[model samples]
Target: MTAARAWWARIPDPVVDLVVVAVAVVDVLVSLEDSSRLAQAMAALACAALLARRRFPLPVFLLTLPASLMLDIVFAPFAALFTLAERSRDRRLLVVCAVLFAVASATPWPLDDLSSHDRTWTLVYFFYTLATAAAPVLLGQLVQARRDLARRLEEIEEAREHERLLHSQAVLARERAQLAREMHDVVSHQVSLIAVQAGALQVAARDPDFKEGARTIRSLSVDTLDELRHMVTLLRASGGRATELTPQPTLADLHKLVTTSGIDAELTGELPPDVSTTAQRTIYRTVQEALTNVRKHAPGATAVVRLWHADDGDAFGVTVTNTPPARPSLPLPGSRQGLIGLRERAELLDGTFASGPTGEGGYEVTLHIPTQSG
Candidate 1:
């Protein structure tokens, strides 16, 4: 099917003229014995010119008329008219050409002379002239209509195909989100029970060693719970639920984030309370993604989390820089879209986010969010 389509597409317009030349050429050659050499030469020229009538429709079409001085140009005139009407959108020019051919068709020829006869024969000649001349316009209009209909159908099918692809992507995204919700529910339940048992162990322990172990276990379980909750928040916010609380974090939440992550961090500058909710969420997510990377990829790194407000109070942002980890540890691979998502979020809000390694062998993530109208 594909090969057949390719072959048809490669076939050019001029190929159709070969059949046209054959029909007109036979008429011109048969009249050679009776006509003058000049008349036969002119007829041959007019018929040969029909081969390129589509390329120059009006000029070649006119060449085949009364001025050819021989009756042999034949059906080529009608073919040229069809090509003109099929290709050009100018109705006035087609009408003028049709009128010219009709006028020329009334002239008497040796093969089919009728104008030299009585009233009844003249009427027959004129009827034949108009019928032959009108054939092309009728055929061209039909071809043009079918071509237009085919083009419209192709465009509609292409649009439907694109819509189907997008729907499939949406379905896959929903399935992944459902699976994440189920995993988090089961894991969270187990973690909560561990934390509760560790709390009881801490209360009953007498030996210093056992007391310290119980306390450490409870602390580790609490940190795990926090991380689990953050993951669940992200999953639901993206797909199903938690939309109302998804952007709840503000500039004020950075202090607790730093403490819980066990990073030796320093906080500096004023965090403006009046920042817009969307900008705040982007700001919070930027630091959160950066800190998450630091913990996973740059373990034990000290981070400096800074927030600064513009003097006009219309802009506020945060920058978090973390030193390279003291000792490297193998970290599991993660979805690498965090930085890309942060950049897109910031740009959507007419803000900016920049991240890269610093000269001091640390990674830095910086964001500037414009909150007020200019």
Candidate 2:
């Protein structure tokens, strides 16, 4: 029953009005038992008035009352009453309209022939008709209530979805704040100490080679501390920056990064100036991670940082290759997430990342992104 009503409700308003008018015409024709020309004209007007019931329900209903009184008709007045009941919020007005309909339906026309008993029967019939008139009003009110409920439920669902999104964002912000604190308090402090110790070692060392190594360590430690402070600041900003922070590394900064990597590394090749900031960041991180891996696992290896664009003009990328370690490398703590992260970044840009050992006992990391990717 509910499904059927839903289907019925989906019918267009104009179409429903036409159907009602047609039904009322059929009802009038069925009851038009040799009525006078005036009665016929009133019946036609009542059926026509049903067409405008949705817009002027009260006036249309009043127009139908005269036809109901002079002739035995039902549908035109009922449709108009239902429409008025669906739209009107005044209960008293609805009650009055119902009473009027009942009176029109019960009272006999042409007041020349009447008796006391006939008047009593007419009063009883009026009450019965009043009760019957309540059916359409109640049904129309039910439809109105159902529509209001559906609209209210939609609003509640939207509010809940918005609240859930806000809660998730709050949780993410808290996590970022905690991570920033840990990096600032622990990692930054330790790196600062390493820089200080390396500086002391560089000044005290007698051997030229030892002095150079200490100086390199101090420089790298200082750079790491600078980067750590920047990261901490960004995380603590809670995803909104009050001012422009330090600029991120791009291909232009690649030269400085390769030179300070504490290895015999060479930077080469060039890409289009139009590469997106996100793509540039991805390339920079790829080179940074590749060099870090070489410093830890391939000690004393010479690395070649080559940026290139495909001849077909479809893609551009970088390749970082390192020769085999000249000596055994020291064991370093690592999470092994660098390659996985690089792969994910490439995937996001609809690109490709590959890392493997070369036949010449060297390691190579390559990244290629489409020219259109951002």
Candidate 3:
């Protein structure tokens, strides 16, 4: 039944209107036999009026009443009534139109010739016609309701999709904010240290060349810090959630980090003390993120954090490896963006970051960066 209604709805409006007019004309023709010329003229006018029913439903319906009173016919008036019912929302007006249709259908033409018996039959037929008229009104109302329901459903679906998009945008904004905070904490600490050390070297150096180099390093480090601070401030002002910026960890803090980590871990190996402050911070973060992952995904695991430099002192990095978990790990909520941030940090320093499961059912994370001279 629904498929049939859908197919009927697919018909073009003009085509549907033409079909209604044609059907009304046929109804009038069938009723024209043995009718007076005046009745024929009224029937023709009623059929013609149906062509304009969609634009002027009440007027067309009124026109059909004269023919209905003069001749025996059903299509023209019923079609006009259905159109009016579908478009009109006033129940009182629809009821009045239906009653008018019933009366026009029931009344006899040339009223002076009516007998008492005929009058009784006319009253009975009036009730029957009114009852039948309800069919078109009811059907028209159903169509109107169905159309409204479809439009409302479309609106609801669009609203849900819009909500989902907003939620995704909110998540992305939060992630970017967290990234900014991490950058400010780590980068600001390293650059500030560089400026301090350079200033010290510039003051103590005896040779003119060494003094000039130290002065240049101090100036560049200070400028870089200023730019970095401004950028971070802008990011926070735009939309980042309020957060405290704390002192960043460096190589010196590794021992405390490993000891406090919930996992059993060993820290070993050392690099030259002259390694750049930026490099030291990157090594620190690598170990931090790796140990955090072990505690979350590899519970009861023993980890090894090894810091190393190349034989020629041209490159240096840290490697953190953890054995398979000795106990079941608990489910924990995480953003899963720690590694991505680590990778981005490595890229900024022309370094490499890698992490994956080892052959012994363990996990390994490694960071490699070129050494920078102080």
In model 2, the runs with Cα more than 4 Å from the true position are: 1-6, 239-374
Tens digits of per-residue lDDT, candidate 3, 249-334, equal 67889999999876699999998888776777788888988997887677668999998889998888899999998644545567
Q: Provide the global lDDT of candidate 1 against the true structure.
A: 0.74
lDDT of 3: 0.85
What is the clash count of model 3?
Answer: 0
lDDT of each: 0.74, 0.88, 0.85
Error of 3 at 364 (Å): 65
Per-residue lDDT of candidate 1, residues 35-151 (tens digit): 776676667777788888868888888777753335534576787788888776677888777777765665545445334455466467666766777778778866666665565
Ranking by lDDT: 2, 3, 1
Return whichever of 1 and 3 wins on TM-score: 3
Count of clashing residue pairs in every prediction: 0, 0, 0
lDDT of 2 by residue, 1-374 (tens): 87997798899989987888889999999988988888889999999988888889999999999999988887889999999988887889999999999999998975457799999999999999999999999988887777656654554465467669979987897898789889989999999999999999999999999999999999999999999998898897774334356356677889999998767999999998899988998999999999978876786689999999989889999999999986444455678799999999999999999999999999999999998885
The alpha-carbon lDDT assigned to residue 266 of candidate 3 equals 98
Overlapping backbone residue pairs in candidate 1 total: 0
